[model samples]
Target chain A: MIVAEQKPLDEIRDLIADAGKVLVVGCGTCVTVCFAGGEKEAGILATSLRMASKLNGNAQDVTHLTVQRQCEWEYLDPIEEQIRQAEVVVSLGCGVGVQALAEHFPQAWVVPGLNTSFMGLPTEQGVWEERCAACGSCILGLTGGICPIARCAKQLLNGPCGGSQDGVCEVNAETPCAWQLIYDRLKAHDRLDLLMEIQPPKDWSTSRDGGPRRITREDLRLVAEQVE
Target chain B: MSAADQVPLQIVAYCCHYCAYAAADLAGVLRLRYPGEPKIVELPCTGRLDVLEVLHAFEHGADGVMVAGCLEGDCHFQVGNLNARRRVAMVKDLLNQIGLEPERIEMFNMSSAMASQFAAAAEEMTARVRTLGPNPLREESVS
Candidate 1:
């Protein structure tokens, strides 16, 4: 899920200070699952903003709306009229959702209310550790499901870097040595031999290195693009 | 605005049913004293306590908040307490960004057997909040 943390209240307050009408948009995808930017968050943000505005003696009109998935066009279609009416939009979604909203509504000033964090899973309840870097590769099979790309301090593909000590990353004692975790998992499975297989350096081309990328499937070809 | 006059801190306490909430109930049964100021919000599991709920509490009027859950691996739901720990950390970061004292929010992991622990936590959180005073959001209502 696209994990996002809320921006500072002062920053947010500043963003809408001059605006007369503000719309808080929430996404119902990765952010919703993380409880960062979702329907509930949108409502809470709207309430907080309203309260802040009231405190400042600058009462402003605020609206809250949540789409099924802000990253997708169809999901955002329902809120088009409302989106157009607002002078500014504060997206409580991930970076993608904010960008998608920006693209859809070029005339409105779009503001991001969240700082999109790394892609991760709820490792334990509220704790979400980065698990995938989306480096355009999958090596989980060799490392017992742990992605070194995200966990390893250096994203080491071959093995533990010199920074690892006593099975912990030097960067932070709380963080476990990703390579050590891999080694232990491999040893438990009696597949220690797989560690000897040298992994090729990750191909950066497939990742976010070269601007935005696209993946098209034959079955999912766009008919609109074909006509254009 | 006098230093002698402390702000009436608003605190939200999320009590897990099986552990923290049960412990709180036990405190009541024993007549164990704890702070009454912090509004208690009971939940089936701390895992069910969303970050937005915490934010909402702060937005409404909470000066500080804490989530009390079962000890690790002791949750009635097996992992709810653990999830609460992780969620609280993220919320702490969010709170920090929002100019609120991150220390205002915290999480405590304990079992039902720790009724004293629960009371102590409540007292401690209330004291911490007293030090922090009421949230700035409550200023409008105050004056």
Candidate 2:
């Protein structure tokens, strides 16, 4: 899931300070699961903003709404009326959700209420840790299912870096050395011979270095000529 | 008249059914006297409490909020009280971040047999909130 944390209340207040009417939009997907931007959070934020503005003697009308998935256009269509009525929108979704809102409503001032942190899963309740960097490549099969790109401090492709000590990363003693984990797992599976293969350098172009990435599936695409 | 002279402080206490709620009942059975300002909302477990519920209490003019659950290591469901404590701490941080006093909300751990402790918690929280005065939102509602 895409994990995010709410921005400081003061910063959020500042963003909507000029608007007379504010709309707080929430995403029901990733941000909801992470407990950052969900229906409950949206309502609480709207209430807090209203109380804060009232205390400042500059009371503003704030509305709260949550879409099924803010990244999808159809889910956002239901809120078009509210978006049109609002002078400013504070999106409690991940970065993608905020951008989607902005793209769908160009005339409305849209701002992010959360700092989209990373693609990860909850390690435990109220705790989320990053797991994937979404590098547009999958190499888990070669590394005993442990992701070096996301877990290693240096994103090393092959063996453990020299900085590792006692199976712990030198960058942070608390972090388990990713390569050490791979080695231990491979040894248990009797596949230690796999480590002897010299792997080539990874292509960085598949990642963000190549600019914004898009995946087009011809099978799923709706051809413009089909409707006619 | 000053703001303090207006409405009495309104505090909400969410008590777990297995412990704190029964403790409150015991306090009443013993004829123990505690502040009457706090309105009790009984729950199956404090673990089920959400951060939004605490925030909404403040939003709806609650001068203070408290969550009373089973003592640490003695939850009826094993970890309900512990989970409640963590969430209460989170709510306190959120309250402080929004310019509200963190003291306005608190969590207490006590067993159903600790009737005196229940009354003490009520008195302690009531006095603390009285000193903190009414919630700022109360003033907004009044004017």
Identify the leading candidate in terms of DockQ: 2
Task: For all candidates in order, state the fraction of native interface contacts they contain.
Answer: 0.36, 0.44
Worst 10 residues of 1 chain A by lDDT: A219-228
For the record, the alpha-carbon RMSD of candidate 1 to the native fold, in angstroms, is: 6.6
Q: Model 1, residue A168: what's the lDDT?
A: 96
Model 2 agreement with the true structure over B1-143: per-residue lDDT tens digits:
76764657788999999989999999999999998988999999999888887887887789999899998998888898888998888888878766788999999989999999999999999989878888987645443
lDDT score, candidate 1, position A37: 86
Could you give candidate 2's per-residue lDDT for residues A171-201 as a string of tens digits? Answer: 9998899999999999999999889987789
Q: For model 2, how many clashes? A: 0
Candidate 2 — which pairs collide? none
lDDT of 1 by residue, A1-228 (tens): 667787877788888889989999998888989988888888878866775675566767988999989888888888989999998899998999999999988887899999999888888867888888887768899899888988998989899999999999999999999999999999999999999999897888888896688878978876565663
Quote the TM-score that chain A achieves in each candidate. 0.94, 0.95
